[model samples]
Target: MGSANVASTLVYMAERCTSMRYLKLIHAHAYRTCLHQHTVVLGKLFRFVAVSPFGDLSYAHNMFDQMPHPSTFFYNILIRAHSHSTTPSFSTLFFNRMRQNGVAPDEFSFTFLLKSRSFTTPFVYDTHGAVFKFGFSRHLHVQNTLIHLYAVGGVTLSAGRVFEDALKVGLDVDVVSWSGLLVAHVRAGELDVARKIFDEMPLRDVVSWTTMLSGYSQAKRPREALALFQEMRFAGVWPDEVTVLSVITACAELGDGEMGRMVHRFVDENGFGWMVALCNALIDMYGKCGCLEEAWCVFHRMKRKSLITWNAMMMVCANHGNADDAFRLFEWMIDSRVVPDGVTVLALLVAYAHKGLIDEGIRLFESMQRDYGVEPRIEHYGAVVDMLGRSGRLQEAHDLLTSMPIPSNDVIWGALLGACRIYGDVDMGEKVIKKLLELKPNEGGYYILLRDIYVAAGRTVEANEMRQAMLASGARKTPGYSWVEA
Candidate 1:
């Protein structure tokens, strides 16, 4: 074949190469045709093996090592691939080698390096310096990546400076630049500032809208998040899976089942129903909305269930007081070879807690670290304590609290205190209140709870004394409010 035809044929075959074995055959063919030495041919082959689903990084590395003169493009492909790998530090190592080989690093080189998950503050600063040295500090893509790196590191000031510098230099900052700045403020919990920036953006894409929505959802402003979703739709911006996930989470928080159903229907109609993450979010939304049947329907319809999917369904059952179903799901999860993580075990423990299965709950709690290799967290301890307290096992619950490896928090102490009032154990109540006071001396609610306990126990003198103590402490009881969806 002619050289031009040979190169075209090799490029076509390389594009269709599905497996490493097939790729090797193509490489061997290129070698026999004497085109393997061509940089373009090698670059094509290297890119496929470095990034394709069936590609092998180790094999790509070998090919790179054999190249007589590797280009910046070759270095970039490897660096980008490694940036998402388990050891993202390899991305920097490749960059160092690229510099050593005298291959000029482009904006993409710095962009991928800044994206490395192994980034520390010092590493980020070092990269920021390199960006300036390479004169790529002005490149919007590189600048945006630096913004994300700074934001994630909680350096909102530095991130803002990068964005401002871009604007000062007339860099034509786009949606990504705005989104990166929004993320910086959002990560710092400065949602108001983020919203102002979002509003000020000359143009907003799905990413800009999603980042703002996620910030609101994560900051526990679910109502605002939903309102923004309405605005997003009205602005004619189609929601991606990520956008829908945040909206569903907001709906879950508000317990707005009607809104959840609407989001679910949108997912189905807009071709987002196939995403496992969206399905998982839908299950959680339905579960929190007290729509167990709807949660179950979503669960059963999923063809591929992740560990999170099972945990969400199990928690749904547990939340609705369906302990038996939760247990059944656990068994089925085990049969399906989906190993239970901390969340899965926590869901089962929550089930035992709600059903008042004291023995079962205790057994599971004890075996958590030993059997499932999942160490119990504070939430697990809290669930078990709440369970024991509910069953009037105040002493046992108190003992568990004190004996826990982690220090007891007000919620655990409060659970035991509430139990003491229920069983009219004045002595235990006094003891629990003392511990609670030590933790939260100015908490008026704890004092009020203790005063109520004293009144219930007919200890009028102590009740009067507690009332005086509450007034003297100057601690105000937080007003209670309820949410009613209109």
Candidate 2:
């Protein structure tokens, strides 16, 4: 076959080789054509095997070893594969092998190594030393990856240092580089630093705006997020699906129905309503804003729904204490053959607990493991405990609390304590109060509950004793406050 045919065959294989069998066929064809050693052919094959769904790093490595003279590109290909694979240590292994084989590394090699999510800080910094030795430290791609690595590793100081070094070396600071530093500060909870970096940037794109908006939302500063989102709009930067999602969430946190409606209209006006993620966020936002009808309309109007869309709709029902509707949605989800996950069951459990459906909640909790294969997490246990306790099944609640596989958290014990007060069982309340105090002796909340129980029972002396204990522990309940928009 001519070289042209061989090149075409390699391109076809790269595009269509979905399974190992197909890869082997291509490998055999390459060998027959004596194109196995061809750099372009081998590079394409190595890259496909490294990332294909049917690709195996071990098999790809063996293929590379068969080459009489493997190029640095082949080594880099394998290194990038292992860097993302579960066995990230293999990346280092292959890097060492490349050095021993006298194959020099390139900028891509160092960047991909740093991109490995599984790398430790010590290993990353050691690799940084290699980047310095190779004199690729100032390579723009390498510097960007370093900042990202430090940012994700929560080593914000190191990321900032790298940024400063880039400035010193006069490397052009691209938007990606600025975004990396912004992310580093945000992850470190230094939003002030993040905001400063954001404001100082000469240019801002949708990404830059979205990053700050997401940072504020995650940090529970919803007002700030909304404010920045408005600034993004006024600056004429178009909001992507991600930006809209963050903005909708901030509106939800504020429970601003008017703002939620405006966002909903904006989504329709901007033709972003087709994105299922944006629609799901709209459902959640409307639900939180007490617009159940609007939330339902969004859910029903969507052309397609992801699992999250269904989950969000169900959560809306659960939030409104509409247990029947929540169950109906769960049934619909099952009929649609969208397998229910732990979050699905969690929402249902909250609904059951909210409506005080003790028997139903218990049945669902038991069925979660057996029927749906969803393991019982701490939140699930808390929901069941709350369900039983609220329905006056104090003994059953306490029995489940004591016998559950996981250690009981304060929510579990607090549920039982509240039940003890409601049932007027002074003896049980006293016993549970001792356990509670042992768990958190300095917690003013539990102390207040115990003292209230004693006072309600006309046990003045015991109430006084509980108050003294609270004073000795230096625990006091801070006054509750509310915000009004008047």
Candidate 3:
């Protein structure tokens, strides 16, 4: 490569490479090569590296501090990097600094700023005035980004306004624009809207079909995703890995083995049987749909088994109430040199917990980190906690919560709160209940737990208070029922 190209790439990597280590190596090498001596060269270099792995707010501030008069070009790069950076306060800091620096903000600069604030709906509106201040509301990429922000934030109407504007500008709307809108439609649970978008696609690519399929799956419209799949097949759109995954998951949800078997045939005929994910999904589909034999067949037929494959089988066994088979499968999985994930241990512990073998459950739960080196997620914790709760070791369950490295979330707290009511430990139950109410104020289960705890403690007045709170907040308790093929 020429010296000019090398210098340019050095600038680009500094500005764009997300990995910190790679950026540092490049930075070190360029420093040695004197590629960073030129002010223009170093300025571009710092901008590209702004969001790289080693980049922090200090690095950006240092760059700006050293420059005599940082232009919009410099601030734009800094602002853009801040968008991808980990700190929100830093973005706010830089936005405040932008006005003080007397640097004129550009479209790219504002777009990233708006994107950084996209998580909060009200904060996003604040960025809108700034976008208009920079006069970039009409830019196609800027508008499209806003549409996506709106769609993700669950405001389909606001999303539509952006899409309509994109059309008015005759700004060649691509599949991404359509896909984003479809996702928003899907999130709204408007399957008809998703279907309309699917039909209106003048051109449907893999993502276009995949989006509709996923939308159908999410909204519990598996049949529609399946129909779209059939249409995709007829239209000769080559199904990628995602298409097969959606179809398999849809078949699983349908719980029709005969239908699942047909999908199996289609998958095999398409020569996708060798794909690990497809195999995993097929096993899951057949297992859940009561075709355990087919699931085992698909699992064994795979040339290689992934950790997910083993974990999926374990889950299937546990779900079918075949705890013995589940444990045996876990043993085989361990012998086969696969490092188990949190799912595997949790499934095994749950099986043991169900059988009331508290010792076995405890052993496996402890072994998760000790033997497998896999850190337990809340699912793993929940299984063990529920085990202890059901077995009437309420204090032990509470102790587990105390011992956890992280604070309990709603599900964990809810389980313990449920345990308190079960064992009639009103005081501890109230403690869990208070935490739940404080953390997840809107969770209906907290009120239900509060009432149940009061009732268990024979405090009728407190129970009435909880009921009144539930009514006042309009928090409906989720059904605490489960079906076991009864």
Candidate 4:
């Protein structure tokens, strides 16, 4: 084949190549045809391997290394790929090597580096300096990336300053810029500021809308999030997987199964049923909405499942009092060679507790470290204590608490105190009140529980004294409220 024919053929093959094996075959053909030395052809192959979803980054790096003369374009592609890959720090590593090799970074190189999750604070500042020194600081894309980076790192102030400066100077601001600022405010927990920015935006993309929705969700304003999701749909903006997931979460928080089912239908109609993240969100939505049967159906139908899948399903079962089912699913998970993490162990313990299986819960708590290699944390200890206390084994629970390897926190102590009230052990209840008062004198819960215990035991005078103590302690009972969708 002529050189032109060979290069054209390689390009055509690279475009259509889906498998690495096919790409390798084409590379061998290029090598035999003496076209492997061509930078354009090599760049295409490198781009395909670096950016394509089917591409392997390690293979791309190996091929890049084999090139006798790597171009700046090839270096940027590799850096960009690494920035988004699992090991984002490799982007900086490659950039440093590029600098050592005297390959000056283009605007794209710095832009990708700025988006890296692994960039340290000092490194970000240094890159900021480099952007100015290289005269790319004025580049709109680079500035937007800097805003995003700062926002993601929880440095909202710096991001806001950058965005404000850009707008003050009348720099060409786009949806991304506005969205970044909005997200930065959301990350900083400045919800009102974020909403103002959202309202002021000249144009809002799906990302902009989604950011506001997520901000509302994060702020625990599920009602507002759902309202925003409806507004987004009414605006005719197509919801992506992320937007759909956020909406489902809002429905979960609202415990609105009707809304959740609507989102589920939308997901299925939009062909996101195969997206694992979205499916997982569906499972969570159903579970949170008190639809355990629907959640299990989704779980069983999932062709590909992650560890999170098992944990979520198990938790839902445990929460709904399906302890035997949760344990059976856990056994099946172990049989399938899916290694259980701490979440899985915790869920099973919760299941045991829900069923009031004190002995089984204790055995599992003790065996977690030995069998699953998952060490018990304070939360696990609390669960075991709560379980034993709920089972009316007050002394055993107290003994376990006293013998705990870790110091007991207010949660564990409260668990025991709660049991003291349930079992009406005035002696133990009074002792618990003394310790609880010393630990947290300001808490109204311990005082209220003690007062209830005294009243239940027919000690009206002591109950009156406890009530007076509560009043003098300056601790007021916080009002409790519940929500239901009309």
Candidate 5:
């Protein structure tokens, strides 16, 4: 027991691994001892994730299934992980899977699940059944979840039904319930009704203010959101990370850097340093607000910077076309042991490809599987095709196209056709046009690309024939798109 306890403590400490190599070593040791299951600490989840990093939801599902006796707690952890960087469906699918396994859900399960399903997928019926099945229909938390599910799930009428049910059952109609309905009302474009609920609530928290602020913000009521934000601040309700995140997002959309700076001061004064999410949000806010220096400062200051943190920061470099700086940061990120996933790869590849750095693109791409253990997904493949096609190595691009196990889809074909126009390979262009026509027989753009290739090669007859085919297909390309960079 002592040995197991000591090992668990060690596993807990391993979650603090600052270096990627150390994280991998800790991950290996934990997996060797099967501490992922035996160790009940939440940090084990991070270990499982560190060993089995991004773009693979299958591993998380597999581990969850292998657990000796999975609890709601573990299920919640896995569900949230699966939900993010993917879809809410990941969480909902597993929730159903858990039911099939005869594990009853608790209030927390419904809460998280409801939170994941944001005003989408009509789960009100299933949710109601789950409540009755679990005999938690009368439980305040369950009712709160039911209200949340319908309100967020976009079934405004159904949410009202749940609220009516809450009233009939004499359940405690507290702030949470009203908040859900208020959000629903606001979502249904009933901001006036939402405001009514806000005024009627006997008590309000920072979340209440944040909710109204978000509602107003989304509805283009920034003045109202800011006004309510001021009113809430005067009410002495301490703002939370949620409030800060929402306000920062709003400020970014409006390009309100000064307002964002005000929020930043509040965040700093409140000493919310441990909230890594807020830290990342601060970085994102500054980046969007055109404060890259401040964004960089926040990124380095963050005690914990998730993959998104790196991606967000990397994007600023990518946008500036600071290819050298972007590549430098990307190299530093991978060297520091941060696992590069599809987003990381795609962004950096774009920078390299735009800069005509073909060698660098291929090297980094090949290292995905050989060095990083990340299987190249379709997105990665698309980036390579785009990179090579744009660099005028159409033949190399065409050769590489045949090697992918995945079919050469529209994206690849589009890149090839684009390269055809740039490099004017009429023969390859003609061949690719057939492939494109086969896929999009009615798409006028394919014929236009073929015509453009022929024109560039001074093959007037071929260009005229392709134009005739466009007339035959009754498909026409939209006006040439303008690409202006400041």
Candidate 6:
């Protein structure tokens, strides 16, 4: 065969290669043909092994090593592949090796390298400097990546500088640049700044809208998120799965069954019903909205269920006090070969807690790691503590709290304090109050709870003392608020 034909044939075989065994056979044939020396042939083989589901990075690395002289293209393929892998650091290693091999790195090299570091590492700063040294600072793709890297690291100042530098140089700053800056501000907890950037973008893409929408959702400003979704729709920007997922989450947070159903209908109409994540989000939205039947409907209709899907449904049952149903779902989940995770066990514990089945809840908590290989997290500890506290097992609850491998948080301490208020255990209340104050000294609610415990116990002088202490500490009770769809 001509060299071109030989390369073409090998590329075809590489594309058709399904398993490692088949890939190895093809490699052996290429070696026998002496065509393996060709970079084109090796490139195809490396890509197949690097990217295919059954692909092995080790095998690809071996193929790369055997290359007499790998080109920048080959190094980039390796770098890009590793950028998405568990060891993203390998991408940087490959880039360094590329430099050592005297292969000049291109914009793509910097893009992939930036992706690998997760921006948490100081390595990102070195890569940023390299972009300037290599004179790719003006490269749009590379600049976008630098913007993203800085933004994701919560370095809003650096991200903004990169963004403005691009604009200053008359580089066409695209939505990616705008979104990256927006994300930087969002990560820094500056939603208003992110919104201003979002509004200032000359062109808005799905990603730009979704990033802003998600910022609102994550910041616990669901009303703004939903309102932004409406604006996205009016602006004729179609939402992708991620955008809809954010909308569903916002609806869940608002506990707006009506809005959730509207989003669900949109998901169905847009053919996004096939997404397992969307289904999971819908189930969660329905559950939070107090629409148990609707939540179950979404769960039951899902043709493919992830562990999260089952966990969401189980939590729905737990949240709504459906202990029997939660347990039944656990059995069904196990029967279907879906192993329970920490969240699953937490849901069951929550269900047991709601039903006042303290013993059962404790038993499940104890056996979670041994039986399901799901180690108990602080959440499990909190659920069990709440369970025991609800049953007036104050001493046991206190013992569990102190014995917890992880430090108890304010929420767990608050749960125990509430129980103290219920049972009029002034002594226990004092102990819990001490711990709560250590955790959240400025939280007036805990002070109020302790005062209420004193009042209930007819210790008016102590109650008055707590009020005075609260005032002295300049801790104001947070005003309560409620939310409705309207």
- Name the top lDDT candidate: 6
- The TM-score leader among the candidates is 1
Stretches of candidate 1 off by over 4 Å are: 117-121, 335-337, 369-371, 471-476, 480-486
Off by over 4 Å in 3: 1-40, 51-61, 120-123, 168-172, 256-280, 297-310, 332-346, 349-486
Candidate 6: misplaced stretches above 4 Å? 1-34, 50-55, 480-486
Q: What local distance difference test score does each model get?
A: 0.88, 0.84, 0.78, 0.85, 0.74, 0.89
State the lDDT of candidate 2 residue by residue for 197-285, as single tens digits: 99998888898899899999988999999999889989999998888888899999999889888888999999998999889989998
Sliding window of 10 residues with minimal summed lDDT for model 1? 477-486
Candidate closer to the true structure by TM-score (higher is better), 1 or 4: 1
Task: Report how far residue 231 has shifted in candidate 1, in Å.
Answer: 0.7
The collision pairs in model 3 are 14-48, 14-49, 15-47, 15-48, 15-49, 20-53, 20-54
Judge candidate 4 against the unseen true structure and give its global Cα lDDT, from 0 to 1.
0.85
Predicted candidate 3 versus true structure: per-residue lDDT over 1-486, tens digit per residue: 777887877776666666657666776767777675556577755755575555555766765786677777777777677677666545556776877877677777767777777643365677766776777877877877777777777678878877887898677887778877876777777778877987897888897788788878766777877888889889999888788788888988888677678778878898888899989999899888988888888888989999999989888888787899888998898788787888888788878876778988888788778888888887888888899998889889888987898767888878888878878888888778777887788777677666766766789898888778877987666687221112
- Residues 283-304, candidate 6, lDDT per residue (tens digit)? 9899999999999998888999
RMSD to the hidden true structure, all candidates? 3.7, 4.0, 8.9, 4.3, 11.9, 3.9
Query: What digit string (tens of lDDT, one per residue) describes model 5 on residues 1-486?
Result: 565775766566665656546555665666766665554543465435523453235545565666777777777766666545457777788788778888878877776676666534665576677767777767777787777766765567877788888888888789888887877787788888889988998888776778788888777776777777778888988778887777777777776789888988888888876677777777777877788888888877887768888877887766556677778888778788888777787778778776788888989888977866777777778788878888788888878777887767776788888888888888888888888788777778788777777777888888789788788888756576211211
Per-residue accuracy of model 4 over 346-465 as CA lDDT, tens digit each: 899899999888798899999999999998888898888889888888888878877888877887889999999999988888887887888888887788788888878999889889
TM-score of each: 0.91, 0.87, 0.63, 0.86, 0.58, 0.89
Better of 4 and 5 by TM-score: 4
Write candidate 1's Cα lDDT for 1-486 as tens digits.
798899898898898888899899989989999999787788889988897879999999999899888889999999988887777888989999999989999988998889984353355888888999989967888988888888776678999999999888789888888888888898899999999999999999998899999999999999999999999999999998899999999999999999999999999998888899999999999999999889999999998999999999999999888999999999999999998999998899889988889898999999989999998888899888888988988889889898998877898898888888888888998899889989988788877777777778788889889878878989667465111112
Clashes by residue pair, model 4:
none
Quality of model 5 by C-alpha lDDT: 0.74
